[model samples]
Target chain A: MPQPSTRNRLLEHAEAVFRQKGFDGASVQDITRAADVPKGSFYNHFDSKQDLAVEIVHRYAGGTDLSPLGEGDSPVARLRAYLLGELERTEITGVEFGCLLGTFASDSATAGDRVREAVGEALASRSASLARTIEEGQATGAITARRPAGVLATFLVDALEGAILRAKTAVGPSTAAEEIDIALDALRP
Target chain B: MPQPSTRNRLLEHAEAVFRQKGFDGASVQDITRAADVPKGSFYNHFDSKQDLAVEIVHRYAGGTDLSPLGEGDSPVARLRAYLLGELERTEITGVEFGCLLGTFASDSATAGDRVREAVGEALASRSASLARTIEEGQATGAITARRPAGVLATFLVDALEGAILRAKTAVGPSTAAEEIDIALDALRP
Candidate 1:
């Protein structure tokens, strides 16, 4: 097996620490130590901690496995599948760490402009995906809606993130799944 | 006019700084400086910084000035009204601070159990209020739903909070309000 590239290794380590302690809470030393990389190597790999954080968020936003949402039979079914996937992720992580972007966004001090832009683009993309699914569902009569497709799509994404935040706060991943079902129920005919 | 009590003054200042800087990010000196109180006076008002933070959240959670969702309205309308009130608050503060309790709950690592419990109770209460409004809306037929009243209500609260977080990150308070309208729109018939 090919050894993980140093850049990839640095990003993986940064993500872990960033998730554990947030952008402001985590230090460069902590990140380098966690990555088991020398300080000089960390600088060589990334320009600054803030830059590394931006990249970490970009990587996560870039690589979310949204393929399952694409394969479902209907819009609502696809949305439910996506929510279930998030719920399963919570189960694996034990609800301590939530969406990395969300974790950083909640901290006003670390509200970096680039981080914000990346999140907005990612969310906008997700909203567009959901809108497409809703439109498909409407065209096929698999779903019924009186409002604009974009509105419903954005609502679903907003609710999912909020539900996850509450679940993480309550220390219960199951709550997030259940909340998603509530939104899903609304989408059913 | 009667002067505000010292304890109340501390709570106000702490809430502002805490919302902007988070638990670990805000320091005692910052709190005292903002309040214009002497360093020694801070301890005189509260047990510690953690104690003061708990009080601040408790105070904010209970201090919403908007009227409650009244009787006779459909639960959906009432729910919409309540959410609108919260959105209005975002505008009032320019969304500069977002939700204090949410900011706290999302970043309470340095805070003790008291602070966590205070925020949790507030969130739970907020969820319960929204759920009750949904139940009322279901009875009136002005709004329709597919899930149990409690679940829909919790989902609504979760979604709104997520929207606020997104708005804060995106630096567009209006986006948060718009996103909230999307979720509240779901309850309409």
Candidate 2:
């Protein structure tokens, strides 16, 4: 693969900075500094910090690896694999940073319409993905169908996001993992 | 009751401003302007923004009305009442603003140790309160003992926080209410 473009580099670094410092806390100058690109170059790529934020949400949402969920033999296994895969990603990002979607979601109210819409779409997509898998689980009799699959999917997303938030504040990733495990276990038939 | 003091007034207004704009987004000027107090008086009431944030977390945590949970006869009723009551509070705050504890939790990693600790303690207290209720439900055979009550409580808090985050991004409170109902239903034996 070829090297990432300057815009890509900015998105990559900006995502990390925004995750760590929040949308309001991370200035354009800070992102530029992190990307090792000139401040002027920022506007050359994205119109404003808000614009970059919407792009970042889109990029992060698109990058979620849902393949591991498909790899497992049973729906329960697939769901577990999916959630654990997410936990691994959280570990890679470090517990301190948490999930980008969640961070953005928390700040969405104050983040303006464009960013909020991006975040809303991103979360809705994620929940939909989870819901599809849950529907599969219900069909396979591996998960309870006590509630609608969409509701369960939303619950999963919420639990995972909540776990990530807790992990950010706690000492390590174990709290997050444990909390997630309980949530996944709750799905068992 | 007597009228709130100047410091109390600042704390109240500052909490709302911080909730609306986040800790980094809301500046001293905005907070003072909201409180209708001179800028210098801010320092007199609190050492710094971080100091005020810590106090806000404390006040918010202490003020959480777990009394509704106590009022219900069954564990499930108590849990539902507690969560619905929370939803009402969220409505009062407006879903756009989300939960203060969750908002702070998402920003905790970047918010420095004092703010992080305050948020952690506030969340932990909330989770513990929920856990005690869950434990009561378990003993009464109203909830399953499949997982430890503490883990279940954490899951509940996580799901609720996540729902609030979604509510902030979504069109209305119905999504939050539905998701919360599903999560509470999951607690059934």
Candidate 3:
């Protein structure tokens, strides 16, 4: 196996490359070049580009900081903070690629069934986490009672994904922020 | 130059292939094979893959049927018809590939600046059309005044895109329809 740092660097830089280029658009050569690693080193670490993509999905989801969802005083407040934190992460990373999960979702149709499953599960996991807070908000009367908390959580995540796609084309925060706020606002009583 | 029928087949089959495989995932060879045209004949019809993609975007957007948005009795009812019509279309077409416009939006990052602009304009035009209906809804008190008509229209489009992304993974209309309905419901006064 390659050194630990080389493996880490491959994951980091390849994520950026994959984000910039869809699964088919980006090549191992592009990823290696981005990571500044020897082209031959790629196979030594990953079985294939698809294998690397799956790993990247796992690592990206596992690495998200979800503490913001629990930090604020009210449930609605926490929900807003968690979502805005997501927006903040996208801006800081590179809205040009949008959210890595979303990027994967967009490319999942042809990236392989495994990639499709990975993104689907990742999106569902995030939605579940948000649902917990939304449920609390509904109980506390901070959110509306018309829709199920779980349904509302999925709406927020779905809208956020769409907004991220816009940010990819807009290459900025304004449009995405506006779209996300609309979903968040919809949760209100 | 190739015959008109050959050119027409290329467009129809290329849209399907690209919708299924994405811009980066689909190649001239793949498109030609699907269209049953010679690979070399591609260059005779278009300058490059990018040029073909630009034309595809224009054609896809131009081909959408927006009559459903205008046929219903009330503004809100018309909006619902339009959205449900979209759902019906996704079912009739391949939901596994989602909307062609959205597929391009997702792939636009690496596809090229021209493709990106093509998708951006397509999405904006659609959003603008939706906004006119929303404005009418607001005037008739079918939609809330809390947000501008344009803002609500953009939100609906963004949310719909996200739902379509989910359809790509689920390979069905159930989840996408539910997600889309939530956004439509949010527009209620």
lDDT of 2 by residue, A21-97 (tens): 88889999999999998888999999899999999998888889999767757776777788888878878987788
Error of 1 at A6 (Å): 5.0
Write one digit per residue (lDDT tens) for candidate 2, span B37-131: 88888888888899999998899889899997676478777887888888788789878898888888888877789998888878788889989
| DockQ per candidate | 0.52, 0.68, 0.61
- For each candidate in the order shown, give its overall lDDT on alpha carbons: 0.71, 0.83, 0.82
Pairs that collide, model 2: none
Q: Show the colliding residue pairs in model 3.
A: none
- Model 2 TM: 0.94
Q: Pick the candidate with the highest lDDT.
A: 2
Candidate 2 Cα outliers beyond 4 Å, as residue runs? A1-5, A171-174, B1-4, B171-174
- Candidate 3 share of real interface contacts: 0.56
Off by over 4 Å in 1: A1-6, A39-41, A171-174, B1-6, B109-112, B140-146, B171-175, B185-189
Cα lDDT tens digits for candidate 3, B25-49: 9989999999999998999898888
Ranking by DockQ: 2, 3, 1
Give per-model CA RMSD. Answer: 2.9, 2.1, 2.5
